[model samples]
Target: MTAISETSAQMALRDPDVRVMLRVRADEPGAFAELVGQYQHRLVAVMHHLIGDATEAEDLAQEAFLRVYRARKKYRPRSKFSTWLFTIANNLARNSLRSRQRKPVTPFVSSESGSMGPHEQMVKDNRSGPMQKVQRKELADLIQEALAALNERQRVAVVLNKFEDMNYAEIAEVMGLTTKGVKSLLSRARMNLRAALAGYVYMDGAPAPEEESERPV
Candidate 1:
């Protein structure tokens, strides 16, 4: 079990939930560690996005997985395993944010590629556009600045939606927010980011409102 055969790993991943989890409860060697390796970075990045301090993010993430490991016996597989796993993450992040004397935030930077800060997938989504090179540098700087300026809840919503590609339910679970609440958070995040990056994205002689209104319409 130290090294799972590819076929075995694929089969395990495809198997029903209870089986894979039961494998974990039984300590079937790689079962537990595999789970850890698969989830660790994403979980940490989610926490880091919410709490903004990498040290605190790491601590909360450790607590989250430890909570998961401790709960293995009681873990009934009612949903996607990631959903349940992130429930623990959600709670831990909320608790950490509430208990802190000061809210924490991660400084955004472009060169560092550990999970793209926020809206990072935008780069890939628009990868081949004519403005790719210019957009990359502009977007990189804008994302870095915009992320730092967001409120915590908005920040988390943006990360989960824009970067994590999590659906509303998953984001709701992660933020301890209602789905509608998550929607509102995301809307505000978008508005704020649009405003923050307006100069970067829309400045370069793109339009003059009076000129366009007079000419086209």
Candidate 2:
């Protein structure tokens, strides 16, 4: 076996999810369902952020899982199971986006039982006041707009980084880019997001009061 495949085999042995997937590949009972239960929410959320339509996202997520099951016989652990799964998702999402001629749709954020989605969580204030809730909603809208402003590749890179908590190397593997390329892609994405959300959000730290005063109304 090649060195890279050998390393991946080691990783497969260590990753519990990979083991579960291997079981599915072997037609073990309930393994496929377990895999879906483990990753369905995460995959749907990622697809939602990528494509911006909740229904379409669900469809895409289901398709991704279907593809995984269909490809089970050929499955080989070249990386973490999540990485392999998301690589499929990323490709599907990209294709869907490309097929549409219109601008990207605004992402829909769903809340359940007063819980916040990732964008809301990021910009939500600690205060429980009504105004704070309004402001949080506004910030969430702006953040979603900012994300939509990024190109498909940049959006994917940022989503995987922020939402998936994947490091540069893992993201590189999923996106078929070199590590350096992923870094550069994220750098540009951050710059674009910061520009899009300039007055409302700070990329590094909170702006000084004086600087805040200078922000456009």
Candidate 3:
């Protein structure tokens, strides 16, 4: 392994999550569980957006944590633990998608439980309209379709940028892309999403307003 620089090591030590990871590396009690508690929901949400399925997303997120725990012995904090974790997640999601493409696709199974699943949860979180004020379920389905229509890399970049609130650099790190490439990927994704959902969903001809990040590329 390459030696970590003193400054880099210090920066890693300063990160709260990195400190927790260090504890995990040392086999400290509760450290891995703490990491899971901190990131489980976020990873599930991100995976849901990537794969368009709640159950699979939950499974994939759990698998990510399992991999993290397995790798704890080799843990090295070069970046925030969240970044490293999501890099694993992003790779897994891509592989899952690719594996799906190679197999005969199965019919989608809707949840039997009465609780709102990830698709509804996502719409309720992102879209501004009250559920009672609109055809919320139908609209949610449309938005989910729009998001799913994006190519895998575009969908990943868009979800990381829009949902995870990751800036271009952070997204680039997770995706193994340059910041400029992330910007362009997201730009194309936004355009594709807009076109796919236009007239059918967002009738105003304006893109859904997203929180602006300062472009670093």
Tell me how far candidate 3 lies from the true structure as C-alpha RMSD in angstroms: 8.3
**TM-scores, in order shown?**
0.66, 0.80, 0.77
* Model 3: pairs clashing at backbone N, Cα or C within 3 Å: none
**Model 1: CA > 4 A from native:** 1-19, 102-142, 203-217
| Model 3 misplacement above 4 A | 1-9, 106-134, 200-217
Q: Give the C-alpha miss distance for residue 8 in model 2, angstroms.
A: 1.9
| Model 2 deviation from the true structure expressed as Cα RMSD, one decimal place | 7.1
The lDDT-based order of candidates, best leading, equals 2, 3, 1
lDDT of 3: 0.79
The residue-by-residue lDDT of candidate 3 on 170-211, one tens digit each, is: 899999999999989999998988765544443334443431
**Which 10 consecutive positions of candidate 1 have the poorest summed lDDT?**
125-134
Go through the candidates in order and give the clash count of each: 2, 0, 0
The better candidate by lDDT, 2 or 3, is 2
Question: Can you write out model 1's per-residue Cα lDDT over 23-81, one digit (the tens) per residue?
Answer: 88777888877777877899888887776677888998888878877888886555557
Point to the candidate with the largest TM-score.
2
Residue 95 accuracy (lDDT) in model 1: 76
